[model samples]
Target: MLDSFSFFNIIEQFIIGYFLTINTVYLALVVGALIYVRKQMLHPSVVKADALFKTELFKSISILVPAYNEADNIVESVESLLKLEYPEYHIIVVNDGSTDDTLQRLIEHFNLTETDIYFEEQIEHEQIRTIYRSPDTAMLTVIDKKNGGKADALNAGINIADTDLVCSIDADSILEQNVLKKLIQTFIEHKNTIAAGGVVRVINGCEIENREIDKIHVPKNFWARLQSAEYIRAFLFGRVGWDYFKSLLIVSGAFGIFDRQAVIKVGGYLTNTVGEDIELIVRLHSYHLRNNEDYQIRFLPEPICWTEVPTDYKSLRNQRNRWHRGLADSLWRHKYMLFNPSYKHIGMFVMPFFLIFELLGPIVNILSYIYLIVVISLPTYFNLTFILLFLAVSIIYGMVLSLIAILAEEIVFKTYDDFKDIAILSLFSFLENLGYRQIHAWWQFKGLIDFFKGKKSWGKMVRKGFKE
Candidate 1:
């Protein structure tokens, strides 16, 4: 019995309601993140990198580099790892059967010689062809294995790791010299700390020399710049806020430190999902809670890793598609944790939030856009003033959140040194809400569709190696 006007009105109200709920949650997260970051800023002595390095309390770490067709950047990335300031840590690189000359390049550059090593098969992975260790340094080891996905490669590295802590990083990433020192300080401070993740910055335009980051600059490419803004917002508020609630779900695979024993205890990484990083963290939470064990997984804002981001739209779309699909797969795989009070905040709050907002947000956003266009185009269905007001409020609220994230970045890390760079980033923060957001939402929508279609392949991610 509803008329056309009534139907449109109901749709508009529903959209508004959805927007209100999502934005309200974001606002609360922003506030929580700001307070937590402010407190950390005031107490700078909580984890002193310098002091930790001088003391004997520093834990040994194993850096795991899983490379797939990374012939171009493998050498430089390994050299960078060799230069880390940590006192006790070794680098392990797993070559997952690359078609390129990745294994040969590592052998030639590092003078790696095949060696016999025995390791416990804690996790199932692809067959290992052979293991190589550097005779010159003795600190570096490389595993040549058959073609398996990234998760499988990581599991291979974890099997060979002898250290107390395992640090996972992308083959293309460049870690700061003191990154390990800073991350280990947390594990020392909190005995129950099982996992900790750091901020990952875009390295597209940064100046590098001798495998070290000499200077940081905003990327010249428009898409890369938009992603820079996105990273700042996500790392600054998203992870930090979740850390405050003790329900942190994701620790970026780009740079995350984990207790080796704990990871082994939880069965290591699942080889089937592309979002193996998030899946591992969620499982850790569930495992610890179910066992009634005291544990903490943290997201540190200080430790930084610089990595390349997609500059072209095609590459960006592929990357987002893979990421969104991974998110969907992980959530679906662990659906039992949703609203199960026995798991506490993680089960009742974080899991449900990711399901309602993170995974399905793109669908709602795309539908809202279609509805808006249809309503605006059809004169009989349109209510111009109401539509305009609704859009203005929605856009403004998003802009405000973006601005707050920017402010949080400036206050805490201030990674972008130049005032002009900050200004450009601020401008992009506003601009992103306009066109870029929609495009990103579309990519995620496509990802969800692909997920439902039972597609599991990871589309190609073309990376222009970091400047050196």
Candidate 2:
């Protein structure tokens, strides 16, 4: 048998090999984005043009909200929708037969009246009990249906969506005033763009007045604050870098707009998977690839939605578990696209990276930790270079991503006002790598194990409720 040093060396080599391999690709993408953004900043596209919000050329969108047992959030959520600044848009609220007062609240709040409106049921779903509309509020429509999942509810909403584009948002989400205008501007500029995803910000511990976030204050609780840093790094640095490579795999479900015809052509949302958003995007890309059609899925760096993050550990764990299962389900379902040359960048890099890193990274991480502890326990076995390299690549690299996100926020939307919050965020950036990252890795591992065990569980988060 090999000596302890030899065993540690082998584990270290494996970790470094994979880490460098992934980071090399990420670095290349990041460098390309630096160049692209330089040009973009110099020449403001329609996506950046402030005047586009006032333009008439922006396309109308159908906002589809899938709600279940969200009575606490429905009224305020709809009220926030009424405050949106878009010139033309309609809201389709699908009540997925909540056991609570969700349907009653919506009915009373909107002064809803039954209307014989025509709808095309392109996709099958649970039966709809009734459709209600308020003559005073031309932009709002409610569909009361049986207890279907989020995906099913979305399909129900899509059938009644008369607009050219559909924007899927959660009931607990609040959109920034100009999010729609900016998103549509990109669709207009990039004629072949099939879908666009905007940034999602954490609303926990934020100062809220009039149902809008006026300031972004990092939560006092360690978990909540850690997530604040986590979101920034994930989106601003990680996602933007991936978008630079044109290899973005997932458009977050919190807020995303899709071409109505494209979504319909691809058979709409798949209710089987927990991650309907990512699955639908994969299907869209797969459909285009099969037909040899040229299309693009885009990302806008602006924060479009504010959502409450889980303040407690249990809630956070459940959310992470759901996300992990969703990732696994999406990847497995679209396993056909993996390494397929026909899909180009998506198949070559994005899918493979997710399969190895995003989906399986947790297992590798847990194993590495075990090996590291073993090495540290036996002094003769330790490789200092191995430990240092791990710290540099994973820990330091994470901090760099957070720093980039901070700069992005400062450059585009200045949300944080207090210098204390800034300093706290900077400190949390380093602290998160120590513990929170491992928790996330473990969550993904649990998700993987749960997948294999044939155990299905929905993550039900007890919301602090929506603020109006």
Candidate 3:
């Protein structure tokens, strides 16, 4: 029989090995993203919005906003979308039976009146209650539908959209003026590009004027500040690295552009899954690969879209839970793609990485922490020096990865102008690993449990709206 010391030694070695492997993968991703981002900086795609606006080179797009109890921010969000510097596009707002005054607010603010329009039902959706249009602004339209979830609401908008491309955005998000222009440039540059996503920065502390982001800064709230760093790390390294490998699985539902015909061909978003965005992208990749057709789904570092992140712990926890659950749902729904060479890198690399590292990462992290505590508490099995060394190395390595992500952000898009803001963000990047990361792991673990229990509902998120 193995003694406690030997048993713990074996467990410790395994845990350390696992940590090293995950960190090594992260380091590789950081290197890959840095290279890609550097190349982009050197040969930057010059976006001439004036020329694109004057010419017919850009395809027409329809912006879809699905609102469920978004009365506070609906008007501002719609106003922001109206000001997009794109030549040919219209806005479609779907009010998914909000108990709040979301629909009423739109009707009153936009001068919306009942209008009759015919649209092909390309995807399954709930019954439409009414369709409204604004006489003052010919570009705005609203659809009142039954209490269907976000996916169903988006499908309704997809069916109603009469444009070459469709852009899906949350009702609380604010897009930069030239966002569409930049996205359209990508579509024009790459004819095979069927879908693309933009970066979504937290707007909690941003200065807004006339429904537009006037200035950007890190949030005052500690939790929000931590989330700001998290977003920067995720977008700067995670998505960018995945894009570098050509195995990107998710284009955030907050702000993503898609080819209309391609989406229709794939049967649109999966209504039953919590992760409709990922499911749709995976299905698109699978469909195109199986059919032997050319297609490209990309993540663009530019073209910023600012959104309101949850400020409180409860809201943030709920949001993280839903996200993890969604990830599990999406991955399991497409399990056949795992290690299948026919789907190329997406199947062999992306799917496996997400399944092992992303989906099961929380469980491993929590278990390792618990085991470390247990070993440390037991004097017979305790190795104080080993525990201290292991924790110090783990934390320092995490801090280094966060710093690299921050460096990537600074190098590519210098969105934050203030040196003070940069310094503060850097500080939070290091601090996030201390306690926030463990809390995040716990939230994700709860999500995994909920997924196993067949929970499909998205928990409530209380939004305070963007600071005006």
Candidate 4:
């Protein structure tokens, strides 16, 4: 019933429709995020930690670090944790069988001695090699165990945690001094809060002095600069908007605070998927909703964590690949939640958006681009007005959203002091959409293919040690 011309027209329209629709969603999120962030800015005071200690809502916290071959930045990461401004919190560093000198470095730095600290094996993980405690500091403890994945390491840490909350952090991540105080506020205010995700800003450009972030500047490296803008878009608007919609599905593994009991109740992190972060959040939602429990998972718009983003193409490719594979793996594992009425917005809106736009977007975009190139090269009877409209809608529209995200960051946080930083971000916002987007899409597609081929290994990510 469809002719060749009609079929091509439909394909072209679909391409435009896909990008247009996703960007439209992004635009809505940006608006919501702006409204909420601006409102929060008016109330500049953060909750005082001393006052919270007297309240019943106050919960002791265990900062969980899951490390594997993080010799370069482990010491600095630990030092950062030692400096956080929170009351009644202990730091638990889980050394997940590092073949490198990761274990030796911690011992030398912290004077860690082996201890027989027993913990119940509530959640399954690889065998624990030994437990160590720092005689120098009362708050620091180390758990050396057989090589388990990140998820398994976190579960082990959760089991060892004697506190009411567990704050999972990457060994390379640095939390702000007041991050815990700010993150814990959600739980303190809303008694039903189970988990809260904080913003992860790129530390590549920022100046690190004396093992602390001293000055903020846009990254000089082109790749890092592009990612700086991407992070702004993803966090400032993307997650915040979803949070406003009450369908926040992802909390970055880099820095997130969770109730210890709630995590255990959901059966701990799943070691089976590389996307442990997303899967855990989705699982928490499914578990709470099914049980008819009142709970809230939040995304705090304030930039609370600063971590490195890959500046090189190879490392960037690996990160993006792993992320896509994780997305596919997580969605497939929770297929039962897709469009199910009982799951609420997670099933009705979030899951479907993830499956269609977030999961399959790379494939659709690549195929559509190939078609566009072929059709343009032919110089045939395609409508010129339609082609122009497609370019504007798909390409320019996304660039606008990126700029809006960058400007929003400027207005809300004022992290980048100089106006030129905003200018540079604005320029990269346009540039990234041109070629970088294509390459990123290809990497994500490869990840999806890797998922189908049953690849489970986390791709290698080389860390460029921060200069203190």
Candidate 5:
């Protein structure tokens, strides 16, 4: 019964509604951070490292790494942390009852000797068998504890962190040497800043020597290349924009720095949620606004952490599913924040955008595609009408974001040099919209289903190893 104009109108409405509802806030954030970046482009923190090493100005931080049977990269990960350029910090590695030789590897590498370190049992966690410290290297402390999830492991680390700040990194990820310095500067420069998240880059194809990224190269595997494109789109466009509006909802646990007291005040990390990083940030903002306290959480455009992307499809799917479930769980658990005026920016903008575009985005997208195909099958149909329109809209938006991310890198970090990489990246960005985007949508959709079914297992990642 619907006419062509009416049918097109429905599609138009969906597109316009999406733009006005989510993209506006996103654009606002992009513009805001761009302006901030342009303004502070010349600031010394943008380049220099020694300035960030001042003990009086820099905040003391404790780095927490929770390992679960990660014998492959445990020692290298710790060694990378030990070599960071920060002035004052402590490393706390939680051995979460690994069946592998994870404990022995650390002991042999770090020459760890057991110590009678007493920690206040502030947060409940599985019992710790022993705590060891490298007597020769004053900054290292390792906790041999029973198997608890990442959240519980982090909580144990938080209890023993005798510092003003805490930074959490994934067990297998490698951080840029200057990551802590840049993150800590934010806390020092901005008095109200509670947490700071840094950009994470793909290291799968990059030449990495001594646990640090030495060169940038696109992965030979298609999935890894797609992920590299995804990361560029995500960090540069998504996060930068979110932070600009002061409505950032999630800080990636890959490399995030937080105020110790603020995290502790909110009762540390939640053991129940897979997306504990996001939940804690949301709760922190909720408490701040509810109690009328001023605070800020920000992200830096600089690449602060380099992590391996899954080369094969299976591992990538698991990672995406876990991430999607995290989004769903965090959103559903904090559903009260949606449109609640008290939480202000987070309640009004961040929560709603996440629910609509991120949490339910998979279903909506899949349904829309299905509806388009059905419409095409009609006898007197407009072939290529929806197809062309969708391509025009998606490509324009996608390319713009990629370009911005590239621009951000060009202006700030300039990590990649080869002009050919830019062309390859550009092609990858377009290719991502064709099929990879839909695949991710399906992964997220599956995650939503698993979440409803009460799935809580941290899906394991099978690695081919990041050898470039």
Candidate 6:
């Protein structure tokens, strides 16, 4: 019906519109995050650590660490958790049938002994082999159970945690000394707060001293460097922006604090889904909104959790693939919330945004890439203007978003002190959009395929442990 150029012109317009639309939303999110962070910083509720100890807002919490064959970092991670500045909180480690000497290491290191502590099993989970507690530490508890997934392990930890709030973290992650103080402040300030997530920075390039991150710098490994930028953009703008609208959907599983009873009411994390973090959060929203209960799920920009990110190609691919599949799985599991006015902004705007922009984003991106290649191969359609416009909208704009995220991190927390590391991050921010982004899109597309094909495996994740 139309000539080659004319047909391509329509496609080009659609592509540019899509890019501009998404990027513009991204830009708005950054702006919104900036405003929200500034407001939170100046808010009167910002309490000092010592002052916070005496306040009525102090709530006892349980730190739940689900470890599976995390022998290399288990000791170090637990030692760091002991150093956290929370006034009163217990550490509950669930060793989910780790073949490695993960449980043995804890027993030897912390003098863990079998305890006959009883707890109500509010949620369904596999049978526990034993429960161990350390008399010396008086705060650490370990649960040995059959090999269920992370969700099942967390549910086991939840049953034993009698505290009002529970903090879920990866076994390899090192929390900032006062992270609990910062995260708990949310619940203290707002009684209606149901759950909240903190920022998780890459720990690859950091220097570890006595199981604590002594210094922070951009990751040295190539893959880790790119992911570092990706993490910055994701936390600073993506989650923060969503928080501004009170429509935040995801509170990263790596580091999030939740109300204990609320989680139990929602039946804890779903054992079947690899995306238990998002699934639980989405369910929380659905449960609260449908029941006409006023609640808030927040994303806090302060409290930092330095975590180990995948450093190699295979590991990184596996991680992203699982993440995309998780997104798809979460969205599908709660499809009832899509475009339903009964759920308010969460159903109307948040769900649709995730569906079109996040869930199917990779598909749209890959299709555009294919169209570009086909057009460029045909000599008759070799128009420089068209190619430039596409690159400008797609590639260059992404780089800008990354740079803004880095600068925003600097402006907010000044996490990276070395200017050279900042420069390196900036370089990778530009470089990632060139080839890496397209490849990432392909990986996510494959994940979508895997979801439909009913792939349930978490794939092998090999960690090189934290660098010195």
Consecutive 10-residue window with the lowest summed lDDT within model 1: 44-53
- lDDT (Cα, tens digit) per residue for candidate 2, span 1-468: 998657667778888887777666666655665665565566655455457655666777899999998887778778888888777899999999889999899888789999877888888889998999997898999999998799999999988999889999999888887778767777877888889887788877777678777677888778889998888767665666677778777888888999998998888898877778889988888899889998988876754688778888898998888888888988888898999998877887789889998899899888877876776787766677778888788767766756666666656556688888888888888888888888889988998888777655678787887543
Q: List model 6 lDDT by residue over 1-468, tens digit each.
A: 898668778888998899889888998998899899888778633365457678655899999999999999999999999999888999999999999999999999999999898889999899999999888999999999999989999999999999999999999899999888888887887899999998889999899988888888888799999999988999978899989989899999899999999999999999888799999999999999999998999998888898999888998899899999999999999999999999989899899999998999999999999988987898877867878888988999888988988887887778888899999999998988988999999999999999999998898888887655
Model 3, position 283: C-alpha lDDT score: 93
Please provide, for model 5 over 1-468, each residue's C-alpha lDDT reduced to its tens digit, 9 standing for 90 to 100: 998878766875685456444545556666776776665567757354455454367778999999988888888888888898877899999999989899999999889999997778777888899999997888999999999889899999999999999999988799888777766777887889999898888877778787767788777678888888888768866787777767787789888998888988989888888888888888888889999998999987764688777877888888888888888888888888899988887888678878888888788778767766766786666556666666555545656666666666655656678777777777888788778888888999999999999998768788655453
Candidate 3 lDDT by residue in tens digits, 126-153? 9999999998999999999998899999
- lDDT, residue 195, model 1: 99
Clashing pairs in 5: none
TM-scores for candidates 1 onward, in order: 0.96, 0.94, 0.96, 0.97, 0.93, 0.97
TM-score of 4: 0.97
Stretches of candidate 4 exceeding 4 Å from the true structure: 48-57
lDDT of prediction 4: 0.89
CA-lDDT, candidates in order: 0.89, 0.81, 0.89, 0.89, 0.80, 0.90
What TM-score number comes out for model 5?
0.93
lDDT of 1 by residue, 226-315 (tens): 988899889878888888888789999899999999999999999888799999998999899999999999987778899989899999
Error of 4 at 162 (Å): 0.8
Q: lDDT for model 3, on a 0 to 1 scale?
A: 0.89
Candidate 1 RMSD to the correct structure: 1.6
Candidate 6 lDDT score relative to the true structure: 0.90
Minimal lDDT window, size 10, model 2: 44-53
